[model samples]
Target: MREVGDSAASGAGAGDMSAEVMVAGGVPLRRNGDGSWSEPPYPAVCANGHELGPYRVTIGVSHCRCGILHRTAQCNQCGATYYLPRPTDRCESTALDGRHG
Candidate 1:
């Protein structure tokens, strides 16, 4: 096998050449195979031209008014909308000195 640092150590500071790394907003951006860097965590179009989301929206429900443990997601095939029950336990950010119920 070849030595590990033989190549990297030789090319230090000239641009590592090992990998192109970029970190933003606690997320890592990578280079694409097409010689393009990825846009930050956002919606993107697919190869077939369909919009897709890399980020997600997480809804935490302490208790559902519908008496369900986890809220149900209503799928609208035509509109593609998901409706969840309202949250019962109210809470505010600890950074903002808000109280939790």
Candidate 2:
């Protein structure tokens, strides 16, 4: 089976830290540039007490009609989907009109 988010950049374990991201595996870190990903990075915590993270490129975002955007990560440990507040300029995500946190 193919591992999720197993891209060429993700495999660069410890390449150019500048060009490569610790989350070169995560969605936000996939973008190639020279700037901060966020002022305060969003957390990827699941209720299961395990850190939710990117397993593949299956991450997404949901935007509430109230204008709260959430960044998402699927738990590799429990196969659960966790949503954190979406920081600006992270991913070109699909928007929704429901509220989720």
Candidate 3:
């Protein structure tokens, strides 16, 4: 796993100091205020343009319901599976969409 950047170190506000870490397959997961990880609000799409679903995050891995690991997701549309890439940071994400304190 790799971290693209740390919001806290960048002088962000206290409520927006979560670090963004890049997991396997380049999928970027944001650290919650409680220290947990979660996917972005927008769904991730596979290379074939198929939408991925049922994104689940555990201890150190994120995956689909199919038991894939390391931020990998499977497309129910075309049965395609692959690692996800880090998405561009957005304003809303910096604040964790208001989900965290």
Best by lDDT: 2
Better of 1 and 2 by TM-score: 2
Model 3: per-residue Cα lDDT over 12-101, one tens digit each = 222464454445334556666566666654446666776555643212334333323333345666655454443233211222233422
* Alpha-carbon lDDT, every model: 0.33, 0.46, 0.45
Instruction: Count clashing residue pairs per candidate.
Output: 0, 3, 0
The order of the candidates by lDDT, greatest first, is 2, 3, 1
Task: Assess the local accuracy of residue 71 in candidate 3 as a C-alpha lDDT between 0 and 100.
Answer: 39
lDDT of 2 by residue, 1-101 (tens): 12235443423222344343433223334323443332224455766777644563247665544344566666667766655543456434444533233
- Give residue 18's error in model 2 in angstroms: 24
Full-model lDDT, candidate 1? 0.33
* TM-score for all models, in order of appearance: 0.22, 0.33, 0.33
After superposing candidate 3, which stretches have Cα over 4 Å from the reference?
Answer: 1-29, 39-43, 54-71, 84-101
How big is the RMSD of model 2?
A: 11.6
